[model samples]
Target chain A: MILEPHQIELIGYAAAFLTTFAFVPQAIVSWRTRDLSGVSLGMYSLFTFGVGLWLIYGLIIEKWPLILANAITFALALSILVLKLRYPRK
Target chain B: MILEPHQIELIGYAAAFLTTFAFVPQAIVSWRTRDLSGVSLGMYSLFTFGVGLWLIYGLIIEKWPLILANAITFALALSILVLKLRYPRK
Candidate 1:
C-alpha cells in the first residue's frame, strides 16, 4: 500500500513517541522502589550507550523524529542505568 | 559536516545494532534469575507494543536498517516481556 509523506511522518512520530516514553515507567519504578535486583546492569549500560549513539545518528540524518525520540530515550535510559548502578542486587 | 550516503548508512547500522542487541543481556538475565522484582511490567508491555509499531513503520518505509533492527528487537523484547510476565516479583 502506498502512503503519503505525511502519513509516513505520522507513523514515524508515533513510533518515536511510543519507544521514547516507554522507558518512563521503568524509570519511575526504579526511582520509587530503589530496587534494581531484577534489572540487568549490562542491558542498561549497553542500551544507554546505544541510545546515545542513536541521538548522534539522528542529528546527522537531520530527522526531527529520530532526534527528539532518541534524545528523550537517552535521558530516560541513562537514569535507569544510574539507578541500576546505585542499587545492586543483594 | 557533510556525510556521504555510505557514512550515514554505516551510522544507522551501528545505531541499529547496538539498540537491538541491548536487550540480549536483559533477556538472558531474566531467564536465568526468574526474578522480576526490579523489572517494571508497564515498561515491558509498552515497549513491546512500541517495537511492534516500529517494525510496521520500518516495513512501510522500506528501510532495511529500521526493518532489520526493529524485527530483531521485537523478538528480543517480546521474549523479555514473556519472561517478565511468567516470573513476577513476590
Candidate 2:
C-alpha cells in the first residue's frame, strides 16, 4: 500500500530534524570548548568519508530522505573530522 | 533509470561495511583505552537515538541501505553511550 504523501513527508522531516540535532550538540561543544584531546582523528576521517559516500548514494537514487539525512550528517561529520585533525586535543 | 542489481547491492554493501567500520576503531579504542575523556555523552545520546530512529525507518520501509548502516551505527553508538555513562572518563 502506498503511504500518504503527508506521512512520507513527516517521516522525512522527523529524520532530518533528528539527524541534524544529533550532531549539533557535539558541534557546539567542540566549537565552544575547542578541545580535541579526546576525539579520534582516524575514526572521524572514516566517519566523514562514509557519510559522504552515503550522500552520493542518496543522490544517485534520488531519494530525498536519504539525501537529506546524509547531507546533514556529512556536514557534521566533516566538521568533527576537521576539528580532530586541526585541534588534536590532548 | 534503474540501477543494475549488482550495482544496487554493491552500494548497499559498501555503505554498510563502511558505516560499520566507521565505528569499529572508536569502539576498539574506547574499549581498550577506556578513555572517553574527549567523547561527549549528551551528543552521543542524541546520535544514538537518531541512528536508532533511522533503523526503525529502514525496517518499516525495507531499505537495506538504511537498515544496515543504521543498525551498525546504533550498536556502535549504544556501546559508546554506555561507556560514556558508565565510565565518564575525565
Reference contacts preserved by each model: 0.73, 0.44
Question: Residue by residue across A1-90, what tens digits does model 2's lDDT show?
Answer: 677768765665676577666777777777777776666666787777877777878888788877887888788888888877778865
Error of 2 at A2 (Å): 15
**Model 1 lDDT per residue over B1-90, tens place:** 788999988877777778899899999988988988889999989899888988888898798878988999999899989988888884
Residue pairs in collision within model 1: none
lDDT of candidate 1 over A17-81, digit per residue (tens): 88889999999999999989989998998888888988888898788878988899999999999
Supply the global lDDT for candidate 1.
Answer: 0.87
Candidate 2 wrongly placed segments (more than 4 Å): A1-13, B1-5, B62-68
Candidate chain B TM-scores, in order: 0.86, 0.78
Q: lDDT winner among the candidates?
A: 1
